[model samples]
Target: MELITSNTHQNQIIEEDHVIKKANGNFIEANTLKVTLEHLKNECIIPVFSKDNESTISHYEFVLKTKEIVQDLFPEFSVSEPDIRTSHIIKGRIPSAIGKPAKELKEHEKTLYYERCAFVMEIPEVVENVNGNKLALTIGGVRAYNQENLFSKKSPEKFKVFIGFKNMVCTNLCISTDGLADQIRVNSLNQLSEAVEKLLGQYDRNKHLGMMEKMSRHEFTQSQFAHFIGKLRMYQFMDKTEQKQCFPISINDSQINTVVKNYYHDPNFSCSGDGSINMWRLYNLFTEANKSSYIDNNFERNVNAYDLTNNLVYSLQNQSSNWFLHN
Candidate 1:
């Protein structure tokens, strides 16, 4: 039987005060706006994914669809070709079938496979010059063998789209929630352009720049940095009310300390003139650990890393009002 796919093409405008329109017919928005990645997910992404459908879209197919949607909506931005990254979670030391292609290995022989495929498109040069930074949009899908749901017979994949900013001088990747773009799962055939424009229109470039500047200016002393680390560690087990949980597994203080030390030791992080540490550096520290810290099949590790990163960002945003209020 042949598979059938639906075409979802639609457009609508959203009135946003923070959106800035350039002379060249391009617009830029800030990440600090009320409309955030989470809000976008709840508003558009979740509904699309929840639609009733007989067939499910594969990760590869979703990437292609997203790429097409993006290119069609914004013709000016330079979009990158789609790329797939696969990691072999289970491999045997001895070769079972030497003649067969490595890519054709069976699931039982391989045991588990992990994949994170993405398409990165560059933001226009004009926008970059205006913002004083280089930026890119990443639309990607992730699927690990253990994360798959076969028994439930549901879609066994996930999708996301976000923006990344690179510092012009320091060259550090400041990964923030792609507030300008929607980070959502490819669940159904739905209108993409309207959802994208609505989110983009909410971006206030000036507000985002101001927030970034604030993060850069605030410097943490040695004692302050240590306190930050303590807060980060505590946040892992505590709830929003600062109530601690009794987990089955013991909390590893040494591992947390090692992760914290690794961030400051890294030379790429931004530092104040007085040699104090910046929030951007601290933020990257969590992001890097989240992405590369775990080699084993501990899915919970990634979840915890994600949560930690969110907590860190929230703390930085309201450092003056109430630091660690969410913990």
Candidate 2:
């Protein structure tokens, strides 16, 4: 199916003052405006997924509110892309052979075949042929794993995400945006619970899948932050050093430490300064570990320190994947 996507933004808030103004006349603040948008947009997508596709594993729809990460992934959606590209949905696949989406893979069944059930993204050259909104992903082969669906839309929810106030006005009615959004603060309570639920369900169906592996803060850093895994011994996996030959290169740990320590003192070291690798991925791991960055520079330095490790880590990750799935 060819899915057409478009975006729109304009000023329609001249009357919003009276409707959304505070007692002081400043306007309702950013969060309030954002909450309104979230409710409207979510209403559109969730319904579509629920009604349209019966087997949808998960779904999320929202305006690409953040330019920081969106622009990096898709240059076309650069400032304009992430800034304007609104609404998104992600549905898991139903377990099936290469050509269909019928058999749903249960999570427990997946764990039965592979050494480990890991998530890997695929950098596909052509996207339309792929499922859902995932850029792409690699299912570490285990029969049920490959046969299991990671991205699929079983219901009509596929379009629910696109049915928002902005979408209705901008895309459908061809109207403009209002100034309200600027003042309204929103949150990224970006919920993927449905998706996670499917993953958990899959684990349950397949007895071998077991529960999702709960890595310690250290194990998390090792897995998500590639560069860190090969060098940093966050925690001793399996009593011995988790020495896996997946990563082929060795980095200068002293250099890495210097880079991070030096970045800490630099004023300009925001997360954006990490020089592109897996900054957000690293951030997630640390967040999993319960770390936060109050200062912009520290954020970038730490993220870069974590991202720079992907090259080394993914190698091992892939190698382990090979062991999990037969070539």
How well does each candidate superpose onto the true structure, as a TM-score?
A: 0.53, 0.17
Question: Could you tell me which 10 consecutive residues in candidate 2 have the lowest summed lDDT?
Answer: 167-176
Tens digits of per-residue lDDT, candidate 1, 1-327, equal 111111110111111332232232111111111122232223221111234333444334455555666677567776665443334323442257556677877754432212322233444342442123343333333333344343454553443444434333222233333342323443454643344444455545455444554443334554556665676567566674554432222225555664566555644443333445555445444433433322222123323443444444445444532243222
Best by lDDT: 1
Q: Which one is best on TM-score?
A: 1
Q: What is the lDDT of residue 69 in candidate 1?
A: 68
lDDT of each: 0.40, 0.23
Candidate 2, residues 1-327, lDDT tens digits: the string is: 111111110111112222221132111111111122233234322321233344322112223222222334344532222111111222343244334433655532221111111111122332211001111211110001122233553312211111001111111100011100111111122333232222323322122111101100112221232344333533223334343533222223443343344223322111223322222222222322211221112222222333333332443333433211122
lDDT (0-100) at residue 36 of candidate 2? 28
lDDT, candidate 2, equals 0.23
